[model samples]
Target: MPASSLSPYTLNNGTPTPTAAHSQPGTEVELQPYTGGDSEREVPAQATDRSERPRHIFSKHRKWMTVYMVSIGGAFSALSSNIYFPAIDTISKDLGVSATDVGFTITVYMIIQGIAPSLYGSISDSRGRRIAFVTALVVYLAANVSLAFTSDLAMLVVLRGLQAAGSAATISISTGVIADIAEPDERAGFMGTNAGIRMIGQAIGPVIGGLLNSAWGFRSIFWFLSVFSALVLLGLLIFLPETQRTIAGNGDVPLRGLYKPWSYYFKLPKEWRNAPVPPAPKLEKLSWRTIVEPLTYVLRMDILVLLSWGALVYTIWSMVTSSTTTVLLKTFPDLTQWQVGLCFLPNGIGCVFGSVCTGRLMDRAFKRAETRYREEHGLANVNVKSQHDFPIEHARLSLMPYFSVIFIVSMALYGPSYDFNDLRRHFAGNLVASLGLQFIIASTATAIFNINSTILVDCFPDNSAGATATNNLCRCLLGAAGVSVIQPMIAKLKIRNAFLVLTGIAVVFSPLVWVQWRMAEKWRRNRLGA
Candidate 1:
């Protein structure tokens, strides 16, 4: 490429800005914000028009409804995992396998869950969110149907991985849709609501799974999922719109065929119906790089710290939830599958509540941070020049310390709550103790989750899905590790000591959040060479 063709320019000042030509040989330019002037062409004549300002074409109601619609898919993704928790024992018995063998199903599911989203996110980031959503649902629906008919343990594990491959995309895609619609300042509430809904699916899965398993056998759980996913898939086909900016261009661009939501066929105004569909933008090629893009984000120190912090909480929560059935069964040997599933309700409820409250709190924090930034820089009443200059890390990380404390304290108490003998003799019944502790731990973990998720998307606005996939990748791998060994760890060290060890590990890493908060902007600037 020519030197001029490789350069970028600023519109307002006509200043030559840095490009690959300006960077040292062999150094990667990680993040370069769009500077509005392509060196290969003249600046567009219409660029000066204030009336042509780029903005989302969606109405407020439509934006939120779109989020809610996609969240159902996210919920299904989570439900796929959580619903299986209650069936572990039943599946073990029916498949003539040990509980440890059944645990591999969860592990395999999580592994695929971690790996598959990079593909989905890459596709959605380039092709369109609708295609990604539709493809995932179709694959997931087929997987669930297969799982319902399978009797072999090895087949069950393999099918579980296939199921994960399909459903896991919804999570990253859901966050991507939020990025496509909401502004950075307003994203927390939207993300919170989405995450909360997703967490709710995870929360209630065991209850539904237990009920279905107890009444209709473990196969019924897969049957229920197949039906629920088909309904969700129908809803997406009918109502979900293409929101990927590269494809939809703020919702005004006409979409055709699979890219167009069924409702848009009649609901779009006559002008849009009659308008021409522009040639689709070139999509990112599906290659090794696209599949591995999320993994590359792990190389960034700031993202690494943020991912570690979030993954630690996620892994601990996974350990706690996975162990719930085993510990509860040991504590209350007479408890039925339904009762064991019902015990998870409080934890789920807490996650839902925490997500809502923390979302509003994060929005408030953003406003406060923005206000302070404006005052400090003497730019009151004006938006920051660009999000790059804003202190988003501070705004988002403000709540981490408080929530981290809550998580640690509750996590430390969670293990002892499993001690039925002590619980019966001293405080409350073992059931009540365990549920209460689980509730607190789950709620706090969710609050931290909302914070981490919001910041991750804000940092990578263009690649929100990819960023979230990276977050999922980290958490799922760590969670798999935590869950796979939790039983043995608990057996060898005792639940109380094992939990204490987990708590100490979290304590050691908790400061990384602080480190990220303090150093994120510096790291970002270094990458941008600002």
Candidate 2:
């Protein structure tokens, strides 16, 4: 916002007005505290659009179109991997590669998934959201198409990494887009919904892959992914408007078709694109340092501890889901790949419920906590609040204890149920534990990640995309490492002991969230001062 438009409190007593020429990143008054009488609340320019304009509006009739569109974008990246899960063995055989070689493809895909979002997020933050989404989708679509054409194992591994580069970014970019549009008050719901949608795709991918592979062959799976991604890309280019508020200047600023890497494409007729548009923030010079900056942020304590807990949570989840076939195959020796895909349904449904339920709960908690904060401080305008001022930790995490209890008890029961060679012998008991375990973990872990990520994104409102990128980088790295240890733990300690140890580890890290929550306000203060 212009200096003249800023509230007086935006600058400390006697402090000079922040000017565009003189101000630096992180120096702007991100949020103007409420000053009764005509003084308005000033949000961080990056996070708060002075103009809040968009090409599309969510009227009551179609309030969720953007969410649905963005969620589709969010889900496809995850869907790309899960859908391929059931077909992996088939692909390995078709390519004359061992099953182990097929597994290595997952490692490569994840490593790239961890790393690629940093670049995409940075690009979206600096350039604009539309182009970045298109670029990533294009790369993903190209990779999938190429994968369908190539049957060689080595090529498959490389193509999978390329696919990761394309698809891994949609989650970060989509989350950034949500932040771009929704205010913090409703963000948890949007985020929760987004997470749920991604999980739905993740949950259904294996089932779709299994059915398609069985009915039409493994090639059908890649073709299907390619077609789906291609459609999403078309929709993004046609229906989805530019959402980077900095560039779009409140949905009102007309967007130019070309932003960066995708700028060279087709030129639409005059009215199809905006006429005159405000210049976007200068694009960052893409380099090795830029690529790794997100990874380096892990050294920061607040982010590190939050991500560490989330990583641990995800590790346990991944271990269970990834090993579904291996663990269950022993019990149901005649299970088919399609049946394996169906087996994933319980976990998927649990995730969907967790995200939606926790998200709504989070919004209510934030309002309640904000009310208490205002009353305790004797503030009149409770509606005017900042992320820093709100009891965000409490708001987002109030249900964590309940979820944690669920995780601990569920894990304890789940592990022991698997001790027997014939799970069918205790099928009902195991099924109950498994479903319950997934439901709780999906809810709890996602809530934790959403809150922690919301914290960082709020910290760098201007760089919400980058903040999410760092979160993605940290969790994915930890998750991959977490996955690597599962087999060793299973081998050395046995399945029952392995899960028990995981449960203990989870309990041990539980304190980190409390510590981080306590420190959030102070950390935020320090961040603004720096």
Candidate 3:
């Protein structure tokens, strides 16, 4: 018998046989021809079921799990930074320092917090996310523990810097995780969730710190933070999985190699190839080349100048509000720390509500445009793959006019009206201002993340994480610079003038938002291609 005529199974006489069922569908059943005299045995086709194919076990849970872990961790980390606000006066008295000096401690903490994110983000890209997260948590825990025992301002500043370093890892890495798991359409929702949680932590931190400080003095705040840090560290160690995509040559590429051609390294000997490829190492060769390459995108006439100015203005506005809260409470001598805490509760609520509303609106607007585009072209509904194609301006348009009104109301009326006689007005202004801040922040942040991340990905698609890390670095570094100067500006210019300055800056930048909104599609087309 020909080999093609034989079945999958062998007979008793060693002759192969074909099974009737295993034959091609719709074909007549055929018998196997036997080379030997003995009869042939038939073989059946292997059983297969559509449902038995291998599928991702954790795929469904991965995104939410990661977002939840990172958000919670990030919230706690941010809480540690600001929870000391209620204790600021107490701490200053204990350390024999002025309020301004004590304020510097917060400034230093903010500066460090801002600086560390980009560095850690780059590390997370080069190393694995799990390692970066775990390492950061451990460092954070240790810093909190150390902070619990610190008595002097110098020690406090150093330990706070270390704490900032650890916290920075969570913020940047969580962002990268969001980019990794979410489709662009879903990213704003994820970012909103992350931002919301962080705001909740910020809301709770001062209040909790106040209660703790009242009951057990300022030192006890660090002890509570230490416990929180320890819990976060354990949770992360157990639950946070690695998410960085592992591509060959990705880890091995050096700072110098970025500028060098691949052909230079590819020509090496087999012995060099066989040598055990070393594990991923930190790229510490911080040259102008490395620094400038990542920042080149930001330096573009169309990009960084506007973003930097807007971020600076926003930071100043936020800093003014934060600084004034403590001072404002001092005016109400009858109000305890607990009352101050209660006052801030409304701000948190407003933030959460505002962020959710803005996120939904942006998402809805993008979907509407997508639907319109499809309808106008007379095409059937299809999956929209990249968010890059959506109009980035709609996100900004939803935000600017609302925030501009709020900003004007806040600066012009809120400050001058706060009197010890009428606490209700103060509370109302705080609530309104908080809502406005949320609108401004959520809109700008979502817009920045949507437009900038897409731009970064398009600019350096092969190294999206690295590109994002650099963008994060600029934001943080400038934020740190802003942190350092914000208090001084407020103190020198006074709250009203400070706010007026902020308002002026915002007003100037407001036009840019419009410009960006109007030209965004053109920029996208020119930069990313139609």
Candidate 4:
């Protein structure tokens, strides 16, 4: 093939003209003219040719609105977990349970968090995103209401797990929804937006939890969550369209009965929304196989390695956040619940900042990778087929080392922030210095988490939710272990030593990213063949 043939459009004086780009003997679809710059690239012929690319009915505005809704949906999981942070001590005392027993509630929550997504992802992938989301929210709403009235430790632990089952899958389902609507090149930005919005829950949950706990006791936290979730669920039922590609291909399929949101009737133009389209395919019956499907990705060495690295990073971060209230109260005995909650403000700020920035950075990296692919292949302005040609792993992981360094340094300093002996002697004695370190730690770690999530979606574009569920399973389980041990570790080996251990673990796990980077392409190709 000639170098000029690489691009779909013929360049006329540096402008792309309408033309067929790729017409290889085995090519499935011919590329149409490139519309303009990087932003307005040619729509895939398959999009219009249903026999090839299913038509995408969502306008850009509609697609983004879907993202925002799912982002809010995903945020409930983070909100539920983070909101409980400030109430740990209060809940323990109220239930007449040991702090360790209270921590068990988190462990159960994490365990459910790990497992529930697989089931939810399966439902979302097969049945529909809307149904899966609605189901999860209903369960979550019920759990919150029950939790508000519970005074028993066992009940609290069980209710938390039910809450996890309800909310944990939102992250996976949201990723699946993004995959349904976005192309490989632009996925990170959308994923980043989703994550950024979700991180808001993480950032503000403690503050809200703290204030609510102080004002009306810890039970009020559950009441707030119940009310918030109910509102979100109502909005979702009314406005959130189904985005599972299998069911609502390209958002073109006119859904019926429960499949269609109320917005389908009012928000969309009747002609466009009611356009003739293929009927939804028969959904597979949910079985053990569907539940086990996500685990298959875990068996892939490259994905496993990537997941392991993410689990390590997430576990470290979870340990910190889970223990923060306890640590702050111990360090400053006079600190009230609200005061301790305020301490989390920096970390939350970092999460929001990091998620958004990392997403934009990932998009830029993908664009750079596209440019590099063209240069290497001696092509001009051609659309490099993302799945087969783009250096996706490298583009996504390019910023991993920087984040790793940030995490390591910040985590090391984090423990010492509370060590009065060290803080008094060192220049890092001030409150600002302490919180600044937390901010850095949260930002960098959250960036790493987002990067892993972005790459996972890239690797399994068709099964984005399933892939993310696998990631959630790994990280949440590891996080459960980390949360289980962190408080005890801090008690036995001062916060400083415990964090140093975490930092060392991060260093030890750093090479896993390199391994995944090296092997990702090969593994993906092998999977395709299989």
Candidate with top TM-score is 1
lDDT values, one for every candidate: 0.81, 0.69, 0.57, 0.81
Backbone collisions counted per model: 0, 7, 1, 2
Give lDDT tens digits, candidate 1, residues 21-101: 453321212222344544343332122332243335677787889888988898876788888888889999998999989
After TM-score superposition, the amount by which residue 187's alpha carbon in candidate 4 deviates from its true location, in angstroms, is 0.8
Q: Residue 307 CA error for candidate 4 (Å)? A: 0.4
- The TM-score obtained by model 1 is 0.90
**Higher-lDDT candidate of 1 and 2:** 1
Native-to-model Cα distance after best TM-score fit, residue 497 in candidate 2, in Å: 2.7
At residue 51, give the lDDT of candidate 4: 28
Q: Rank all candidate structures by their TM-score, best first, as comma-separated numbers.
A: 1, 4, 2, 3
lDDT tens readout by residue for model 4, 290-394? 778878887877788888888999999999899888877777667788977887888888899999999999999988987888788876534354335456678
| Candidate 2 lDDT, 1-530, residue by residue in tens | 45566544334344434433334443222333334446554433333342343223334233266777878887876688778777766777788887557767776777788888999998888777887888999999999999888768889889999999999899888887777766656677777888888878867888898899889888888899899998888777766766776665445455554642232245443443655555655556767675666666566665676677776777677777665655555556566788867877777777777777777878888778777876787665423333345556566667766776777677776777665435354344545555566566656666666666665654555667777887777667766676656666776787778888888888787777677667755664565453
Query: What does the lDDT come to for candidate 1?
Result: 0.81
User: Per-residue alpha-carbon lDDT of model 3 for 1-530, expressed as tens digits?
Assistant: 44467555655334443354343321112132333555454332121121222111234366677677887777755587557777877888888887777777776776676667666666666665666677778888888889888889899889988988887667667766665555444655666676567667666777888898888888888888788878876777655544554422322222122222233354532323455644554444544454345556665544564455445544654464356455455445555766665555544554455545555555665567667765765544333322335454454345545554555455554444343235564343544453444344434443443444443443343344556656556555666566566667766865456656756766666666567666755665565444
**Deviating ranges (above 4 Å) for candidate 1:** 1-7, 13-55, 270-274, 380-387, 420-428
In model 3, the runs with Cα more than 4 Å from the true position are 1-62, 247-293, 377-390, 393-401, 419-476, 481-494
Model 4: which residue pairs collide? Answer: 8-21, 46-53
Model 2 worst lDDT run, 10 consecutive residues: 25-34
